[model samples]
Target: MEIKLVKAIPGDVLLLHDVQTRAFQPLLEKYLDYEKNPANEPINRLFEKIQYSSFFKMVVDQKCVGGIRIVARNNSYWISPIFVLPEFQGKGIAQQAICQVEEIFTKHNIWELQTILEEQGNCYLYEKLGYERTDFEQVVNDRMTLVGYRKIKN
Candidate 1:
């Protein structure tokens, strides 16, 4: 399977929104009450974020199966939301996307991301890709707990 990372444009806002919603539907169903999920964001809000962040489409064999959004803060790259369509989860597309971002954002000395504490798969994926879980977490309401991770370049 071939994977590629491409910069996203304004035209992809709706596509990204759809991917985000479809990918997180299972999590929403599992938790049954996660209002803080990225998939819960409105399309207009996604458009606003796309305007400022480095948005990328995770393309596989010429199809878009996922996307990631990275933002800059205090010289560190923050990968806020990375979504892979449920159908595409087993593949290594998301990992490839993360590697691509590491290459693309080479100027940054540090990278960070956050995810729901219960998402073992996401936590494993980030850790395998060199991110270290920080000793910080937040209780997002009763149904959700957020965990943070960071990777610093040597």
Candidate 2:
């Protein structure tokens, strides 16, 4: 399938919000991470992110399947909440999107992200993409923890 990362515009906020909520809903229900779950966030928060961060729609075969948000500072970049719809999971869309975003930001040498530690698939994906797990972690709930990862490009 053809995959592309299209820069998000303000008009795409509702679509982004919808896709994000749908993509993260199962996780939200599983983890009950109301405060930290994108599915639980308001549309306004997504609008703000679109305005402030580099948000891209993960388009596959001309359809918007998911999104990735990047927060950049100098040579470092933070990737938060990259997701694919539940139906679209296990297809490597998220990995392709991440690689495409990194290609778009070629000047950035450091990439950072966080994922649910309990979700081994998520951890495996990031590690497969060359991200090294850091010591930093946030315990979200008794059943969930967020682990930090960083990739330094040389």
Candidate 3:
């Protein structure tokens, strides 16, 4: 399948909102009350992310299938949310999209992100792409575990 990562424009905000809502429903079910999740936020907040972060649309076969939001802080880039629609998963879309994003941020030496502990696919995908699990672990409301990952350019 053809895949492309395009910088999000103002008109794409609502589309991204729908994708996030659809893509993250499973995670929400798994983590229940994942209050910090961008998917759990409102569409207006996504509009804000568009202004403040490097947001992208994952297009596959000429159709928007997923999205990613990365925020740069100091020397590292943080991926707030990288998601692919449930139907288009297992096709390496997220990896391809992330690789495309990495190409644009070559000056950054490190990339970091977090995923819920129970989401094995999300964790494994990052690890397979060379990210290592850092020592940091965050507990949310004493209910769920969030694992942090980091990848340093070598």
Model 1's lDDT to the true fold?
0.86
Task: Report the backbone clash tally of model 2.
Answer: 0
Per lDDT, the best of the predicted structures is: 2
Between candidates 2 and 3, the lDDT winner: 2
Better of 1 and 2 by lDDT: 2
TM-score of each: 0.93, 0.97, 0.93
Point out where model 1 deviates above 4 Å: none
Q: Write the per-residue lDDT of candidate 2 for residues 35-126, one digit (tens) a residue.
A: 99999889998999998889999998888999999998777999987989898999989999988888888777999998999999999999
Name the candidate that leads on TM-score: 2
Q: How close is candidate 3 to the true structure, as a TM-score?
A: 0.93
TM-score of 2: 0.97
What C-alpha RMSD separates each model from the true structure?
1.4, 0.9, 1.4
lDDT per model, in order? 0.86, 0.92, 0.86
Q: Kindly report which residue pairs in candidate 1 clash with one another.
A: none
Residue-level lDDT of model 3, residues 23-111, one tens digit each, is: 98876776676678656888888898888788999998788999988889999999989889999999989989878888888888899
Cα lDDT tens digits for candidate 1, 36-138: 7776888988888888788888888788898898998988999978999999897888888888888888788899988888888888999999899998899
| Candidate 3, residue 135: how far the Cα is off, in Å | 1.3
